[model samples]
Target: MSANSSGVVKVGVIQQANTADTDANLAKSIAQIRVAAARGAALVVLQELHRGLYFCQQEDVDQFDLAEPIPGPSTQVLGQLAKELNIVIVASLFEKRATGLHHNTAVVLERDGSIAGKYRKMHIPDDPGFYEKFYFTPGDLGFQPIETSVGKLGILVCWDQWFPEAARLMAMAGAELLIYPTAIGWNPQDEQAEKDRQRDAWTTVQRAHAIANGVPVVSVNRVGHEADPAGGAGLDFWGSSFVAGPQGEFLYRASIDQEETQVVDIDLGRSEDVRRIWPYLRDRRIDHYGDLLKIYRD
Candidate 1:
């Protein structure tokens, strides 16, 4: 372990294959977290909505039962675990903020068993296999970094990973690392070539975030086949959870078809060195970038 000022910390990502049973899924995640902590990970991230299967594949109002309040059961369990292991934890959950409002939220648990902060996923997708907008309200938290014992984490959920603005704001806010808890997969009906392209694009975009922001990026994705209960075609979740350095080099990548608990040591200070050489932040003309907030220019 590198000293506090050095910004070096061991991080872990848990890539899991889920079944229909939520209880079983949560148990599996807890077990994997233990394994990661044992391997000396100071920070651990779980796959998006790891407590249950990807319910957004299709929207049924009945699936609302899956959403729980922030300080409810799931965070309680995670907070206890973080305190026990003395590690910072990033966990994604379907949040029931109120009676009719809900969000896809990632909660960061501090080492002292308190809720450090949370990020609601701002980018909601409404594609065929991903019907997130039908279920989630766009995040109101803005692109802010969550302070924790390990460091300030620029945490975002799956769909938010595609936006460069999200990553840039977090970095500007002084996030030490950018972390994403993702649940993305391939449509089984797509051609093999198409599947490969989709996976490659997903990985490439997030790596670009790391390189552009001059910060290490950690993304944990789910794995295995989840046959659509509504029945058209299933999704084969490509489980390639990965961690990349500030320069966008892969530190570790898990297998595409298996469940894994991967731990990698990262020198967070490297971001400073990378940014100093690239000077992306230094050269930014913040005053001239007002167009970024606009929807678009026709």
Candidate 2:
């Protein structure tokens, strides 16, 4: 653990499997955050939608009942913890913006009891077991950095992690680190090779974001088997919550099948050193990127 002039700031990740009970899930997350703070973590991140089961398995109108307001009970609890520990926290939640509007939101809680910033999930997936399009309205918050005591966090949700544009935009906005609160896993029916490929691809893409932006990347994903409400063999959430350095080196990695809380110290200033050596930002062709904003040309 390398400390700066101010002292070392340890970042924590909580990777846990979810059950059917929302209150129990929230309590478990709070306990984990307390454990992480006790271990000296200054910034802690929870897995995506940590309060309950991955209800996106099927799109029932009743599932909307799970969504709550931004400053609802969950945020209140996390905000209180953040203040009590004097630490920064990135927490994911299902936000009910209005009667008919909802969003997959990630809230950044500052060391104080106030809300720091929030980012609604931009990319909504509607795959076999992950049917998010029916529940969430695409995020209106653009790629922006949330300023906190620790550093500027470029917080994006799970599906948003795959887009380089999102990462680049955050870097352009002077974000120091790219943080993802994710809920991705493997289908039980997948072959061993396929499972390996899925996990590898997930990690590789996030690492690429770190390398390309010359910043650290922190990804916290859920673990264990979450049953698909539709039945059959459920989805197995490959834990593997990890943190990568500016040059894409692994700082810490959790197991793929257990609940773990790890507090890893990261040198926030290292990104400047890495970027000075590899000046990707200095050489970007911003003027020509107009074509990038367009859908593909035939």
Candidate 3:
């Protein structure tokens, strides 16, 4: 949107399994980032909470120890990498704000190894397996795009991907691409049919975002199965990280159960082309949407 014409840009998506070892996980993420840069990726995205296991499976107060400050350890390492590779990196981490204050935040590093901008996850899930409300305070920052050297990135976390309003706001604000750093999985004990439905629904909703907004969508999800520390049935993370074109076509999609790194080239200019044919934004009826503000219109 910022005078960037339609051109091919190589985007990287990483899907990896995580363990309880914080140091080990960080090391793995750093290594894959370098691999992506080597493969000519201009911008690379890591999965949600890549620095450690999905501790939200069972929230214990002590799990707060996993959080770190924004400019803290993870940024230092990733920022330096962004500078060395001269590539934009979108990294997600659990942020420790203050005494009993924390957030699930995504940080974007510039090409010069500086903090470009950050997005606190707006929607926090509180299901039985995902007790995120116990750990993260709902993000105070509104839905906004983070400007980077490459383009204006509409960054959202795992749960935020399900909401159309979140994606629409970012697109309305001139975001060039919708990027999601996600970590979602079903209970392994669920029926196979149920698992298929859950995954399909997740994929369909994101593609709908692309089709409606006429912008490309990039989603990076974690791989492998992480057991629940609470001793309940663990979740098997379906590793289907993918990138969709402005028309909701799959540019690239990783395996469903493998640690994968893929770079997909996309035309940033396609949004303009697609909008010319299907101009949903031009025909919106904002006057009739006032009831959307009410929690329940009885």
Candidate with the larger lDDT of 2 and 3: 3
Residue 179 error, candidate 3, Å: 0.5
lDDT of each structure? 0.91, 0.90, 0.92
Give the residue spans of candidate 1 off by over 4 A: 1-5
Question: Which prediction has more favorable TM-score, 1 or 3?
Answer: 3
Candidate 3: residue pairs that collide: none
1-298, model 2: which lDDT tens digit per residue? 1211223459999998889899999899989999999998999999999999898988799988899998988889889988999989999999999999999999999999789999999989999888899999999999988988887889999999999999999998988889999999999998999999999999999999999998889999999898877775778999999999989999999999999999998787888788889999999988988888779965
Sort by lDDT, top down from the best: 3, 1, 2
Off by over 4 Å in 3: 1-4
RMSD (Å) of each candidate, 1 decimal:
1.7, 2.2, 0.9
Question: Candidate 2, which ten residues in sequence have the lowest lDDT sum?
Answer: 1-10
Score every model by TM-score: 0.97, 0.97, 0.98
Off by over 4 Å in 2: 1-8
**So what's the TM-score on candidate 2?**
0.97
Give the top-scoring candidate (TM-score).
3
Clash list (residue pairs), candidate 1 = none
Q: lDDT score, residue 111, model 3? A: 92
